[model samples]
Target: MQTRNGDLSQQNGAESNSSSNHWQSQIAAVTRKLGSLPVQELKLRLPDWRNSLSTSENRLCDLLLAIQCSNSAADIHPKLTQARQEYEKFKFLCQTAQRVLTQNLTHYDLVSIAKISTTVSQPNTHDSAAGRSPALPVALRDRGSFDHFMQMWCIMTKHNVENMPKMGYKLLDLFQLYIQVEELGGLEKVDTEGLWHLVASKMGHVPNSQDATPISHIVKILSGAFVSVLAPFEEFYKERMRRTAAHWNICGPNVTPGTGIVPTEVHCNIANFGVVFGEVNIGLNDWMPEWSPYAKILRLTGMDLDQMQQQGWTDDLIRLITKFKPTIDAWREVLIKFLLEIWQHSQSMTGQHSLQHPCRPTIQFPTSQVPCEVASTIKGAFSIDEMQRAKLVVERLTQDILQTRQYQTCEVPEVQRLQMNYAVVDAHSLAIQFERIASLDYIVFDDQERTKTHLDQIALLKEQHQILQSGQQYYIMSLEEVVTAQQNFRTALGGIKNACVQKVKERQQQVTINFPQPDEFLIRSLLIKKS
Candidate 1:
């Protein structure tokens, strides 16, 4: 009896398998027959065959679902492709019908078209959550929003709305998702093409030509805008990364063994030039640990990573991120330690390290204008009239040399050798740095207002520097003239002294000639007196 029961089970299993095969074969035959129909014939005769085609489509969807439920969708991709082609053919027919009616269609006629458009655009369950519109249904919303946000920046009236094109509802959702991600500071992390692929897959949007849907085209358009902001921010982020690596390379374990103390210049460089990255505002004050800028950036990046993982990131991406953990950890640890050391050193030297007056590093100008401008400003501030007068004196002396022709062969050195008593040139260089530091020092990590103010101050400084640099050329030229005049004067004085000495010698020779008989006269007078 047990053997007979086993035999009956085997027989039933074989019959079930045979039935599935027959069903699959029949589905294949229908797909082949549908494929052979000419596009024109289908267009002209679709209405006659619409009911039969609908019936066949319903059967095919049912079978596909069954295959998915049984975990066998992977075994028959060819049949699925044929089924998809037939579905697209139907979509084409609908599109053709819409074109025919569009010119004559009334507002009432548009209602069904709108409904059909909305139905087609609705996202599947897989790509629904992030993209689902909060205000309007997918069918009711303006499709223009997917292409350009500015077009729908305000309340979009019907007049401004474009005619609905063939696009997936999921595609709209993807754009919405892009907007959300941008708002949330995920623009830097967005992989536009990968994101499209992921979202399309989730939304059950298969790319096909016959459907006439510009889903890919829309995504490409959306992606261009999406990545526009990203490129600049990424450049800045990579610049930060490069700086971080450079700092680590310079001051890390490779530092010569005896240099226990980190250099002040190193501390200043990191403090002044290092930028804050991964900045996010969670809208909660005092929620962070000690309010370090680096800490905030680190937290933001970590949170972004968490979001990526939560959004069904692939294993390869996960692995790539995991590989970076050691570097990230090392950087974090090294930075914390270095900043701590700087703080301690400051405290030891100043009795208290004031966060209110944080180390403001020197702000360098893009041009060599800073030093030149500062110098010129210093010169002007100290004694503008005196410098101009001194310049006039040099110019007059230069005119004398040119008019006299004696010093014509002489050339002034590139740099003037004049000894200036005015202390502003030295003070100007220090003052520029001092003022920048003062502005930056007042900017606390949490004060956005102060940070903006600091940036404005830097801009002002740059402007002043440029103005000073322009003024410096005149001052420098004047200085060179003064030095040259002084040199020429010394040369003229030496020449005059030599001429006087020569004249004196000639007078001595004349005196010697006149006094040649003086000794004989003295002898004659002495002899007469003795007689």
Candidate 2:
């Protein structure tokens, strides 16, 4: 009974094998029939017949293995050619079918077909010059073939527009990840083009139509993603600004503490903001003319204030100007006081007395002869003369003040004493010579004492002249030193101005998006506010 069971099992296995062989033979018959046709006829027949053909990997692998093993050369060449042509035709049909089924198609499918067709068309190790077969393992000798197979796999997996959003999201995530990694290592590690190319290649497919809504959506998504990714950098910049402001004290007024007076804290704050928002306030130039109250005052001053009020003034500037008003008033008072003192000195020196006071001067022009119209016409001339006279007075006063201030401010009393003593010695030497000469004189006879006294007096006079000359030289040297000190102070002030200007320019470049015209009042307001 066991033997009978075993025999029955063997019989069933044999029948199964026979049935598989029968189906294989049927498929081979159909393959050969298609292979025998001309290329054009094959192309026409493929579209209708390819749907019935098996596309399973196992079946394709089986067919390819059989083709490699085939010994009949004449039959194999025709069969291989036919198989290649049919495969290409089928590929085209699949692509067309995909296009019809979906508006969007994935690159994976195209890549897969291209790779598979290339692999199927490639020559096996078995083929030779004389149609002889070489003995080599199908897998071992088919590395290029394997590569083509993988390429086909990639092609078969192509995506459509329906899947594009997902792909785009993936691309954005990939870019973000790369950016984070690059940042961690430093900016040098980032290869922008390489990463962009990789992502773009994966997501660059578009439908053949004018419909751009989908693409636009993708672009918007990308923009949002980029903004999100760069958000951290904003804080970085803010922190940098904070640290810089602290280190440089750039927020404070650009004034030295002791050398001269400077604008108030409010003025400095406004100036610093102007520096910080330089470029951004360019449009403020246009607004200034419309907004600034000081512009009207400037015009009334007849001071060419038109050029001063260009731009960057805003409503907030009123606070700054108000805050700095004390400093401005003080400066004005200093200037006025200096002018009054100069006018008083001029009157004293020129002996030109006025009915008002000894320090004031009066003009002697006849009031009746000159008509008001003529006087108005010549007023500019008289004004010019007055200005020239005032300037002369101021110049002399400046020189005298400088000289007295130098002496008064000197810490070393010995230096002054040396100077006074040098003058006194010179005077004493002159007086002694005169006295000696008066005492020794001869009329008729040649008196040796008189001649000697005269010669001695001449020598004393020469010595006194030398001492006076030396004292003058020393005084000139001291004055030159003082001038140099003043010049250094001026240079330092200039350096400060240049530094402020440079800072302002840099800030302007950073912040200003637009610049107003030169004659706008906004500029004057901004200047005043900043000051």
Candidate 3:
């Protein structure tokens, strides 16, 4: 009986030992699997896992790393279960952030009407992120941590169109707070009012507080964000220009082969932001002023003409700014992207001499050395029957110069010697100058009903242009003759030269010669203002 009792005890003890080993192996397998998760995934889980496992929040990362790196998994079963719970928390936070960002602020008591009526916040003051009723996550204090928030924001804004205007407003508010909390504006000395005035000027009117839709406010918020992000690039470009100024002067403005302009050689890589200073200038020049809150839009962009002036005069910088004169449609995409950056992501501005590819396509200008003259000529092309006749005369003269082969070879030994010495060129130069003056006739006398004084001026200029054209033809005809009347050729060329110079003076008088403002088409503005 004693032997039998002892056998049963031994058998039970062996069974209990076997069960303990099996449980230990299972715990180790689960811990190994949990440890294998990516650190980012682990971090996400750690926050919630801390809450579930009642672990120290500060040690959450250490605890997770240990569990992941630990050879033994026997003590990790509880932690694995906690991490799974934390994942749910992470997901919940993401969803909550999305809903808050996407929901129309109008639907909630978000911004009081009083707040809308109030003027802009005081300068140098910041709105606390935590001041909002439902405070943003503690993690949101770090801009990088808001990546998930930005992703969610894009998703909601893209998917929910009806809610976009409200979303834009809410995003404006949120970003304003974020900027304030981050003290983004404090990083740079931005000209808030100057930027406001710029947008106001762009809109072709001053900003009015009574303007509906808060579009100006939205623009202002976006502008601030853009200024903050782009300020670095602006500085980088300034410094780059400074560094390369000497090199460019030595090598000429054509730094990159075929890229004639010096500014084109410097590539601004403000990472995925898709905006250039040129575009920003264009936006200020053309697009933003068309918005409702024109004043606020200015404040946001913080772009001052004086600031542009203070950008320091380098030949390349001047060319860069000058190159942006004409209003362009390219900035529409950039403006859209700028708004996206407000809620979508923070932009990175790092200038490079070379990029993988050009950020914007090289702007193709016609092969005119004087683009303004060409552009003005295109603008001044005639529409009237009488004007059309005048245009035909100029076209005929240009064609005659091109087709006449006799003038190509110099006939007289004296002429040949002069041609060899680069003294006596072809009639092409004379014809081009005459054609340029003729092109201005239509521009000067564009209106059918002109003042008597203006009509007299136009007639005089037209007569000079015609006299010049005739003289150019005579000079060309004489050049082809073996017995070229050297006196006649000189007289003809001299008459054409005098007429062109005189016509230029007369045209300047007929139309007020307004020196173009920075980034303005003087002629276009004159037309708009006077027409």
Highest lDDT, which number?
1
**lDDT scores for all predictions?**
0.38, 0.35, 0.35
Comparison by TM-score, 1 against 3, better one: 3
Give per-residue CA lDDT, model 3, range 88-135, as digits (tens): 555444433322222222112212211111111112233334322122
Model 2, total clashes: 29
Write the candidate numbers in order of decreasing TM-score.
Answer: 3, 1, 2
The clash count for each model shown is: 1, 29, 8
Off by over 4 Å in 1: 1-218, 227-229, 245-433, 436-459, 462-531
In model 3, where do residues sit more than 4 Å from their true spots?
1-385, 392-421, 424-427, 436-515, 522-531
Per-residue lDDT for 458-520 in model 2, tens only? 333344334333322122223333333333323332343343344345656443322223343
lDDT of 1 at 230: 25
Worst ten in a row by lDDT for model 1 = 354-363
Q: What is the overall TM-score of model 2 with all chains considered together?
A: 0.16
The alpha-carbon deviation from the true structure for residue 215 of candidate 2, after best TM-score superposition, in angstroms, is: 87
- In candidate 3, how many Å is residue 232 off? 44
Better of 1 and 2 by lDDT: 1
